[model samples]
Target: MPKTGVLIETENGGVKAINYGLLTAAMGNKENEVIAFITQNDAAEAKDDLAAYGVSKVVQLKVGSGDINSSPDLCARALAAAVEEFELDHIAGLATAPGRDIFGRLGAILDVPLVSDIQSIDYGAETAVKSHFSGKTMATVKLEGSPVVFTVRPNAVDPVENPVDAETAEFNADVADGPKVTVKEVKASQQDKMELTEAPVIITGGRPIGAPDNYKMLDECAEVLGAAVGASRASVDAGFAPHSMQVGQTGKTVSPNLYIACGVSGAVQHFAGMKTSKVIVAINNDKDAPIFEKCDYGIIGDMFEVVPVLTEVLKASEEK
Candidate 1:
């Protein structure tokens, strides 16, 4: 009856569906007796999707949280209590911004390892998969103790639709002594509203594409694939594309299902952002490009000619 606990985000208009994917990865091949801890902000939005992520139990944590600088550590400690109460084997949270603070506090107090930025979780093996060496490699981490704490990257795992009759319950996740270090003010980024990392399909252009004008072909192909546009650092720095769509070590790391890299040379930094994509298709004139090493399929040709053909084929399929 190996099971785990989930820490769901309910505040700041956060989505709780990511927790389901985290839970699915952590509680693999175990009894369906896991608990999910969510806050008020996301409660309304995250309800139906909890089961879609394979959570068997829902524990909505109520603290005087919402529109206030509530202590994330307090919520984390409360979830720690839930792990003890429900007797779960692991406690998992997201690797997003808020999760960084929550997991940091909980890991220290609980005296357990906090696995962060995990890309996958092997429930049977009790191993957590994380990107390491700045996304150059993947590392599988195992806890040395019980009730392990972990924070996972968003869009890391494919959310499983394993239906379970979940028993929803409310719990007190309030800590007696609040956060040692409190967040006084909030500073939000005023940039492009949409995050390309979370987009289902991402199409990125790299240095090999050569000129700024050539990227339009890549963009056209992206439109054909119904994918968001992305660019490697070289493409962005060379003013071929905007910084917002940059995908690499100094840019947004994406975990899309379908990643089409046109003219990318596959630097370690570039792969850091898109290596997690389920299907990688690389198109380059040079057959020796490093991107070919990790691509599911490769095409040796100029993207200028190849992308147009692909766009036409996709458009024809859509028309049908």
Candidate 2:
């Protein structure tokens, strides 16, 4: 069986739920050995969670001098070392911010092809599907070289649980700090917050949301659903929400399990970012809205009326 490695990313000292999907992709019918590579976390602590998703080994890549979070170069070098040491046939991870940084560097160091933001993959065949031209086209790419790198889009694959007994190991790579870059201190703009990309459910507001304060309704609904709140480009441009919350062709792409678009007109740009969501529910007053055609479910009504009732129903379910 071929051995595959997954570079796991953690949040708030716990394993991110998104990594399980990558693990499922790596395992692929239990014909391959799944090894999880972790940095800035304990292998023993993460072993149980990783094993739940079919990981056979949990490796902790450690550095002696500097923190891996601060030094991307060092982190990449360490992953390269692990890739070689474990004889990893393929490497995969979430196409998150840190994964993009480190995996790009690792691919450069190893002189291999690195494919990012893939929608799906056939790990056994070393092929994947990626979006192109603002998601209007999907390109099937074949990875030709050995030990190829693939970064999957978050929530693109549903996670499957296949329990295993994962063994833990420690590998301290000998990597030196680069002269050009060295992180001094880490400052977080948003920590411990539900991010739009990784959240399983997302509720997005559009231009008709009216004002920034109006997002509270969505927030209440999101709180009930354990979801994150997002905004369309129209709402952001109109100053109803910040750019950080924008989701569209010009903003961040997301693939949550469930996406709720409240008062959105269903512009192609906005749909491009979240078309891969498993289920989309659109609430708008216009019966002829374009969103009705794209969404799995549509409600032709005022969001101000529909959203509050939705929130109340969800809240009531929890109380029961």
Candidate 3:
């Protein structure tokens, strides 16, 4: 059996929810031995959670030279050392900003090809499926080298529980810091909202939202659903929402399980970003809006009127 190493991402000292799905993908019909690798959090605390998704061994990687947190090169070098130390056949991680940075550097360090933001993988075949041409096509790519490296889109795979007893180990890598770049400081997001790409559910507003303060409506509904709030490119361009919250071809690509679009006109650019959502619900006053044709469910009404009722209904259901 091939040994697959999954780079586990953590938040607040716990494994991120999306890592479980990556673990599921690494499992691959129970034919591959899944090893969980973590850098930021305590391996012992994450072992049980990782093992619930069939990870048998959890490795905590530490660098003996410089701070891996401050240097992406150092982090990649340390991970490369671990890949060699463990003889990992494949290395996988989430395709977040940090993941992309480290994996890009790691690919250069290892002189190997890196495929990123893939929707699915066949570990046994060393192949992955990823979107191309602005989400219009999907290509199955075959990796042709030792220790294939790839990053999967968050929430692309459904997590399945396959419990196992896990053991933890520590790997201390002695890697020299590169002189290229060192991060000075990192700023956390001011809003304590779920990350747009990692969120399982997202509620988005469009140009018709009118004002920035009006986003409170979406925020309230998002809070009730435990979802992230997003804005269409039109809303962002109109100054009703920030660019960071924008979801479209020029913005963040999301693959949420449930995507709620309010007052969005279903432009191709916006559709390209969220086309992978499992279920899409659209609310608009125009019954013949293009969104109605693309959405799984359609509500023909003004978002101002439909959203409050939806929020109240969700609240009442939660109360029960």
Best by TM-score: 3
Model 3, 1-320: lDDT tens per residue? 89899889999899999998899888889888998888889999999999999999999988896666777777788889999999999888889988989899888888889998999988667788998877877899997668888888999999999999999999998886563779988888877778899999999999999999999999999999999999999999999998999998999999999999999999999998999999999999999999999989999999999999999999999999
Residue runs of model 2 more than 4 Å from their true location after superposition: 190-192
Each model's lDDT comes to: 0.74, 0.88, 0.91
lDDT: which candidate is best? 3
Q: Global lDDT for candidate 2?
A: 0.88
Candidate 3: pairs in clash? none
For 168-228, candidate 2 gives per-residue lDDT tens digits of 9988887765524677877765534487888999999999999999999998899999999
Q: For model 3, what is the C-alpha lDDT against the true structure?
A: 0.91
Q: Give residue 232's lDDT in candidate 3 (0 to 100).
A: 98
lDDT of 2 at 119: 84
Order of all candidates by lDDT, from best down to worst?
A: 3, 2, 1
lDDT, candidate 1, at 232: 88
Q: Write the per-residue lDDT of candidate 1 for residues 33-57, one digit (tens) a residue.
A: 5667776654435556676566677
C-alpha lDDT (0 to 100) for residue 271 of candidate 1: 84
